[model samples]
Every structure is written in structure tokens, then in C-alpha cells.
Target: MDISTDVWGQLALEASQVYLTEGGQVRSPFASTTIEKLPDKVLLNIFSYLTHREICRMATVCRRWRMVAYDTKLWTHVSLRPEISGLHVSSLESLLALISIRFGPSLRYIELPIELITHTVLHELAAKCPNLTHMLLDFSTAMQLHDFSEMQAFPTKLRYLCICLSEVIFMEGFMRKIYNFINGLEILHLIGTYEKVEEEEEEIYEVINVHKLKSATPNLRVINLYGINFVDDSHIDAFSSNCIQLECLAVNFCNKVTGSTMKTLFQRSRRLTCLLMNGCSLRSDYVMQVEWEKSSVQELDLTATDLSTECLIDMLTRIPNLRFLSAGQINGFNDSVLKAWVEAGTARNLVALDVDSSDNLSDEALHRFLSRHGSQLHGLVLGGMPHITDQLWQSVLQLLNNANDGRYYEIVKANFERADRTTVVRTSTNCRVSNYYLLSNYNDLIFN
Candidate 1:
């Protein structure tokens, strides 16, 4: 007889009784027997599915549960970010106390708000969390740092550091202070918030010297400087010359970066695979003149650039192993570009393509390209195309569905109601295909 359903209610009641009891004393003999049968490993595995708050609540269930719930593995990666952990800003002290008592040396990764990263806190983290290697500090609140010298106490073992700053005045000084501590850092991502000014003049951003960074972190492999206005061709040239093992470099929205830097990277950085330069001033002449012995670049994003049709086609021919290509908001991107890609066999290796806001493309060109490369493509974004009607979308969906061995593909659209409204559609598959339609002035979709 199957007793699974029959005993569930009774077991649940017994479990509740065990939790409510002062010392977690089991009221029923059956409950004690059942609870004892589950080993510590199994209990820990079960607790892994729960949130940090839920895990803390589970500790009240019984002594065995308390032991399992507080397992070091479950607390290795901790997020103190209020948005993610559902933690309040005022509860930071209590959270720090909990981390000191529970996480201790086991915390390998942590995400903290800038407000909580004080001099004392840094020293405490450095002393207590000896094994901590990855840290992400969110400064989106535009918190001001009193002293950069305090960062000398930051954990030295950190290999991955991501900081999100919002027009902070001491950006350069803050980076320099931490540079002394994180010499072994492999990945550094600096994300800056850019506020648009109504005037015609551009807002000047605080520049961090890339040459100094290159000297400090010699073994750097991945660097992403998003919306940092100071990045230019000199910075890219510095990385290309020094950081030989660099794999991925993204300087998206740094309008100062022109195609000259891209040309430098393509020719010098052989191991580079992903290069994102969206919202830069990439001139047609500079791009057309790019010559490389053999570019290892596979993923490239040139969204909102000034590249003409001929230059784009020529650039595509250079990167033979290209898999992901995003050329959104290019006026010169038309049916001829798609036709050229298909003709040159460049569309064969493409797994994802984003041609959003390219007004000149028609249904015929898209349908033709998809018909040939639909099987290989797992992601396709075609937003803001007036030519692609609802009927065309349905036909494309049908074509994609039929191409993938009769597998059903559904479109999930999420509409955000704001000044800049966005509608995103994704497919329900192992691979996600996102098509973001912006009903606002912003032309480029920010991909996280």
C-alpha cells in the first residue's frame, strides 16, 4: 500500500509540534523516528532550497535541523544587498553580527551595499573571512566615501571585484586605494551611472587611469568598464599591449572609444573572444580599414554605432568564429546586410543575432536569413521594425518551431509601465531568446 499521501498530514502536524516545543522535543514517537532517519547530509541538502530567512526560521525546528540549516556550504555565497536578500538597511549591524558568528571563514562570495562598507567593517571582514575571494559593492545610492586610505584593510585574497558607482567624486582615489590590496584580481567590472543632462553639452565623468590599473593588476583576464566616459583608444591600447591573457573586454557607452581602439584590440589581443563597444562613435572608414591576422573575437556588440553597410559586411568577414552579433540601431543595416551575411556563409555559425531598431530591414530579408540559419539561432531580437508586423512575427515563430524538430516555442511578453516602457519576449527553452521593444527614446537595450 502507498503510504505517501496517507501519512503526510500527520507527519506535517508532528513536525509543527516539534518546532513549537521549547527544546524541540517530539510529542509523537513516530515523529522522532521519522526525523532521526534523515541524515545530516540529506537535511542540509533539503535546507539548500530555502532562503536565508527561511533557513534561520528552520533552525528553530529542532537541534538536528539547526545543525543542518547552519551548514557552511549554504552560507558560502551571501548577498547583503537589500533588494536581493529582502534585508532592510537598518538591519546591517545585526546581519554583520550574524555573518561573524555563522559565516566566518566559509564566506567565499558576498554582495554588500556601499553604506555598510566602513573602515571597521573592512578590517573585520579581512580578519574574519580569510577565504573570501569575490565581492560586489553596490554604490548606486551615490554614497560618499570619507577616506580612501581605509580600503587598505580590504581582503587581499579577492580575485573578482565588481563595483557599481553612481557619479562618485572620489572614483579614481577609491580605485587606487583598493589596487594595493587586490593585486591577484582576475576580473574587474566597474559600472557607472550616467545621468542625462538636458543641455547639449556632455557631462564630464571622473576618469580612472587605465595605465595605472594595468600596472597594478598584471594578470587581469576580464575587464568591463560600462558608462565610464574616460575610456578612450589609449586605454584599449594599454590593455592590448600589457594584458596578454585578456579574454573579454567591454567598454559599452564610453562614447570616447572609437573604432581605432577596436582595430588595435582585434590585431593585438589574440585570446579576446567577447568585445562590446555599444554606443561608441565607430566611423565607417576606421572599421573598413581594420586588418587582423586572425581575430579570436566570437561575440561582438556594435549597437548604436555609425558603421555603414559596407563596413559592417567587411567586419563580419574578419571574425570567422562569430557566434553572437548585436548591431541594433544602425540605419545602414538593411536587407542587403542580411543577404551579404548569408551569401558569405557568415550566418552559419551565428547562434544569436540582435538587429533591433534597424528600420531598413524587411520581412523578406529576415525570413530568408531565418529560414537558413533558424536551426542554429537560439536567440533573435527584432524590435522596433515597422516592417515586421504581427503576422510576420507569427510566421517567424512557426518557422523557428518547425526548424527545431517540431519543438513548441512559446512567446512570453512582459510589459513595463514607465516613462521608458519596454516589452520583452523570451522563448521557453534551454536557451533564452529575448526581444526587447522599447517604447521610448532609448535605442539600445541594456543586457545584463
Candidate 2:
């Protein structure tokens, strides 16, 4: 009595149905009636991944989710969208009312586009979000005609602040208002918002002392001035004296800053860790040779500065602890100079080296350096280096293949390197990475 395959399958299905009927009444609840038992902790972790807008939408899902979302910890990050409805209203009262109702006391961090943040709303947020530690306010246009004195009355808990006050008129009292308040600041980024049109030189100079940040935020550790036009070096001197603990200093498009003044200011801050001078027309041969505290500086970014190999050697030798070096457009190094740096192992401890568009580097020089240091290198951002032709990538693969004989090495190459390397690789000409991590990796590239 052998059963056919079809007959056996039918019998098994029938048996399963009979067993289900006899054992459990075979009643399937509606799909909506059943509640899935997902762990609350897992849900919370998922919620953390959502953006502020996404979180706001999720809050309206159900009572339980809404209550959970209302948790103060979850609202610590608030990203205000400029395109959101009811944001463009010029009236402060209506805007405040909407914000207060939608978001309670849970706001800790707020990022607003310059156009959307009304002066009154900014003051109201300052008063409401006492626990605020980070605030990024981008105002790409002229400062509105409103009083910011109310900001002084708000909490001074901000530690990280990035404000683009370019073109904004700062009255005489503005400096006092900021100095009296925002004393707890540690990181300050004051970028001047300048338009292409030429304005009165006096007005440009007038904007300089508008908000004397050095006097206000004495505890500042980092200060970056972008699009800032200063007639003299007095502001830098003031900052050097006041922000004595400064670690990172960036001066971009400050054509008025003399090389001597910059070098002198660099000597003032003992804790200066990173210095960036981009788009400056300093043609001095000795600018790069200026000595700095080697162990203190971990990062140096000199993009679009007119520097030659002579300057490069000066910088490399002086800053021994430099792990990251972005010498963008600093041409003039030939194979000999590169060979010298490689032989001296100046970049042995570096993590990232971005010498893009530099005319000095040659294919042979790059090949020799990567061949020696590629094993320890994690990130290599050498774009626009004329030497990085197809032949150079072949050299890279050959070099890595030679190094991978039982030993371990991790290397991430950018657009310059070929994709066939056996080592763990990430390639791009403009490799996007965090500023801190880039510095750290470069430090490792040099030191490791």
C-alpha cells in the first residue's frame, strides 16, 4: 500500500488543518487586532535614527509613540527647516506660539537657516532652550533691524556656536550685548557674509569691531573667520591675548592680513592645534618656514595659498606632530623635495595628506613615498597631483600586493588610485570625512 506523492501531500495538509481545529479553535484575529511584541528599547533606538522632521511626523502616529517621542532626551536635536509651513511669518508671536506647542522644553540643539530665524524667535528659543549646547545660525544676508538684547537675558549654556553674520549691521551696542552674554562659549565660528558687489571700504571696516567676539567669549578654544575683511591685525592680537587657550584658528579670504602679523599671532597661542589660511595672496617665501609648536599642532590646511616647496619643507619640519596636512595648490615640489620628506619620514605619522592641484609633485616622487608608507596609510587624498596618472595606480597596486605577504595593512585611496587594490580601499578625489577624524587619521599617517 504505497501512497502516491500527491495523495501524501493532500493527507498531510488535511491532517494539519484537523490538528489546528481540534487543538486551538482555528480562529484567526483580524490583522489589525494583533499587537506585535517589539521591544521598547529597540523602538527607541530606531527613533534615534530619524531626523527632527521625521520624528515630528512619527509623534502623531499613536498615543504611545507620541508619549515616547515627547521624552526630553529625544528632542535634544532640533533641525529647523526653512521651507516648513508657517516659518516665513514675519510676526514673532505666532511663530513662537507654534514652536512652543509643537516642541516643548525638550529642545537642546537647533540649526536654522539664516532667512527663517526671526530676531524675536531667536530670543525666545534662547530663553526656552536653557540646556542648548550647540547652535548654528546661518544668515547669508544683512542683519535684520531688530534688537538682540533679549538674547543676553537667555541662558548662557552654549558651548558650540556657528553664526554667519555676514553683511549684518552690528550697532555699537551689539558688541556689549554679546560680551555680556554667551560667556560660556567654547567654540565660535563667525563668518562674514559678503556679497560680490563692492561696498564702501569704511562699511567693511565698520563690520569688523561690530561684535568683538574676543572680548565676549574669553573661553573660546576655536575661532574661524571666513570672508572677514580687516584693515589691520589688531583683532588677531586681541584674540591672541583674550582667547589664550585657542586651539584652532582659520582665516579665509582675509587679504589684508600680513604674513608677519599671522606668524606673530601664531606664536601667541600656545595651544593652537589647527591653522587654515585659504584663498590668501601671500607670496612670501618664508611664510611656510615659520616655526610653530610641533607637538601642539595636529592639523594644517593651506588651500589655494601661493606656496612653494621651500615653504612646504619649513612647515613639515617645524610641525613634527602634524598628522594631517592639506597643502592644496602649493606647487613647487619636485621629486627631490618629496624624496627628502619621505626619506626623513616626516609623513610617517600622518593619516591624511591632501596635496591636490599642486604642480610640484611628480609620479616618481609619489610612487616612492606610497611604496614606503602605503602599508601604514589609511587615507590618501592626493588629487590634482599631475603625477597621479594611470601608471601611478599600477605602481600602487604593485606596491600593495608586495606589502600584503601575511602582514596586515589598511589603505583607502582616492580618485588618484586604481580600484583593483587588494587592501581595504575607499577612493575619491574629494573624499568627504569629518574634520576631526581627518586630522586624527593624518596624525596617525605621520606618527604610526
What are the per-model numbers of colliding residue pairs? 0, 18
lDDT of 1 by residue, 1-448 (tens): 5687768876778655633376765565455566569789888888898888788799998887888887888988777776766345465577667668877999998887877766666777888899998888777675576565655578999878887766645567767767778888878877777444566765665545678878888777788878876777788888788888788888888787887766777777778877788888788887777663277777778989888898887878666778788888998888888888888886667777888777898878888888788767766776656456555555676556422344333332221111131222243333323432211101222222
**What are the lDDT figures for the candidates, one per model?**
0.72, 0.61
Q: Which stretches of candidate 2 lie over 4 Å from their true place?
A: 1-44, 60-65, 83-91, 98-105, 113-123, 149-152, 194-211, 229-233, 285-289, 293-295, 397-436, 440-448
Worst 10 residues of 2 by lDDT: 439-448
Distance from true position, residue 154, model 2, in Å? Answer: 2.6
TM-score of each: 0.78, 0.75
Instruction: Provide the lowest-lDDT 10-residue window in model 1.
Output: 436-445
Cα RMSDs of all predictions?
8.0, 8.3
What tens digits encode model 2's per-residue C-alpha lDDT throughout 199-298?
Answer: 5565454454623667778888777776676533556677887887888776667666556566666677878777766666566554753566334777
